[model samples]
Target chain A: MLNTHGLDVSAAIKTLVLILDLVGTFVFALSGALAGAKHRLDFFGIMVLSFAAGNFGGITRDLLIGAVPPAAITDWRYLAVSILAGVLTFFWHPAIERLRSAVLVFDAAGLALFAVAGTQKALAFGLNPAMAALLGMLTGIGGGMMRDVLLTEIPAVLRAEIYALAALAGATVVVIGQLLLLPSAIMAIIGAVLCFAIRMLAIRRSWNLPAPPD
Target chain B: MLNTHGLDVSAAIKTLVLILDLVGTFVFALSGALAGAKHRLDFFGIMVLSFAAGNFGGITRDLLIGAVPPAAITDWRYLAVSILAGVLTFFWHPAIERLRSAVLVFDAAGLALFAVAGTQKALAFGLNPAMAALLGMLTGIGGGMMRDVLLTEIPAVLRAEIYALAALAGATVVVIGQLLLLPSAIMAIIGAVLCFAIRMLAIRRSWNLPAPPD
Candidate 1:
């Protein structure tokens, strides 16, 4: 039985969301392999890094939101796609750098969409605002965090960037809208747009956190 | 508040169990670092792999069972210990390998203890047999599965190993004893010992599943 206390996206919206999710996974996987190539990793290591980066976000989100069995574990399609992406990445890394700027833009778009959608899913399950917001933020930034950790660099979120902050802003908007009894679709659009805008601005401006004094 | 479900461990036994858990984590972390070393990963990568390998199983368990935030995410001490273990492994690969056989034994011991403990926790929370058994199995092998995935290897449990099977056996015993209204501690000890014995036998015989016909 589905929970009745939250908004259910229309078929069209659901289709859009699913498309974005797949796109996010594919790009994230490619990016992961690219990062590994930068470090001169072997093919096996590249695949491992790519797969981990692609799936970690969604896996963490599903477990947190009480989605039993986890979507990644149960759905062979996602696993198939991830494996394919990883394989493709291993063979094609030399050409990826030419599209580095474009790839970052795509990642930014994913962060925006997942933030709002992930939070909405948690809220639908009747979780508290704090938990829902956290899940949303995680869904957006979790993959990148895993990638950075594996790459031995600080997480991009902890560095200077609007990446995670954009997600947080989007999630905050979602939670507040729910509390205010605003329509979910409208709030979703606004929140997503807000995230995209923030992330884009951050990128355009080379925004970064100031280095701390020792 | 802790729910013991009227089953109690003696302070001595409980202390022993905790020590076993730490040993298990250390072994698991070492394995992760070894995987990283095979890939020629950096110190940061080694530490991250170690942390993930050491805690992913219990973290997955707690999250699946609705333990909010999961111990891996919420506990800094666990992260510290796992990373430390990884660093030590990096600096002493030869020494680590010298103790490889002993590590497996400790891991097996942890598997047996944690599997029974997980099942009991689920039963006390009033979950059904199927869910409790699944979770117990997860607690026993989930971390290693995650480690393998991150290292781009097949999960050890899904192979012909006696891993998840032992956990299932333990959980089944617990369920049957509960149905029969048996004493709790007696049943717990029986179930745990049964799992441990089965695992030892499997390792001794080099038992494994046959490869499927292509």
Candidate 2:
């Protein structure tokens, strides 16, 4: 087991998480970069938005949990993935926009990955399980929140169908599995798949959290 | 000199900074709560916006510099100030809305305080002078940005006359003073005053950063 902050994570599991993280970052970056394009923001603004959407969630999570110099900032690989996504979107947006369904699918996948990753990290930091799960949800939604805010749109997590709830559900699973002493790898996979399924179902069925009564 | 994270600050100075920070938090919270009221958000939403506007900037800055569990979350005093401001605005919004000019002035003060405080904290953390100054600007404008985004309005910092520029100016002064070995107390005062003066003047004269050609 590869001991990252004392988590008994296997090398293979680490690789899986890393790959998922990179894919998630790329998809989110694409979303943000595309939004910037639609707004006709300049190149620098687009790049900034791309990075914010791709990494801001993890950065927020890390900061709250005391992970100094967040991996998104310190790791060149993460930066590279965001940059690549942004550049690709900038140059080929017309084509990418045609794949809106694909984007939605990718977004669900990203949300699931981020949720579990956030939960694991919070657990590693010894946060209470409830708080850990909340942090996990924040990790999934934070970057998208940043992106929408920059674009002057209501945050999807706050307005969209079952978004933050799905992340919360996934994070809850991770925390519960940890408490029950389940294998970390199995728990993580289950959490991600469950989150993805919830999100996809919400999208398909148009499910939404009820708004407060006036 | 009172040693906080190895920085030499006097008790009097610490008290002053704390007072200013709380005042800033209160003012920003008021602004946020007012926005929430205007938007007809529910009580929960108003409270959330109030806290976000009051504390998110400092939270963002502290996270960037690796301050764990940002004071916004850990410090009960800050939370109390935000809740107080929010509750007041929620109940007495009509009266508060009539004080738009006063709110603007208080916001300027809050911006000034946050800029200098953020700069000082960043420097204490050993960040480079340039980065420190930028972080200061972020601290000044971050909460407002969050508030606006949540409200689906363009960020005032992006559109208002010389807003972020004034913050940058104030932060630069803090950095330069630190490099010159000036007393932290005096330096903070000068930075805040300079920032406030610039912002006030910009508002009065309608000065703004130049926009790129359409």
Compute each candidate's TM-score over C-alphas: 0.56, 0.62
List the lowest-lDDT window of 10 residues for candidate 1 chain A: A1-10
Off by more than 4 A, model 2: A1-9, A42-45, B1-34, B37-50, B57-66, B74-145, B152-214
In model 1, which runs have C-alpha deviations exceeding 4 angstroms? A1-9, A211-214, B1-214
Question: Taking chain A by itself, what TM-score does each prediction score?
Answer: 0.87, 0.94
Q: What share of the true interface contacts does each candidate keep?
A: 0.05, 0.30
Q: Would you list the C-alpha lDDT of every candidate in the order shown?
A: 0.74, 0.86
Please name the candidate that would achieve the greatest lDDT relative to the true structure.
2
Native contacts retained by model 2, as a fraction? 0.30
DockQ score for model 2, please? Answer: 0.19
Instruction: Quote the positional error of residue B115 for candidate 1 in Å.
Output: 16
Candidate DockQ values, in order, are: 0.07, 0.19
What is the TM-score (0 to 1) of candidate 1? 0.56
iRMSD (1 decimal) for each model: 10.8, 4.4
- In candidate 2, what are the lDDT values of residues A1-214, reduced to their tens digit? 7465876667666787899999999998998999999999988888888999999999988879888788899999888998898898888999999998999999999999999999999899877787788789889888988998888776756544788778889999999999999988788889999999999998999986543333
Q: What docking class should model 1 receive? A: incorrect
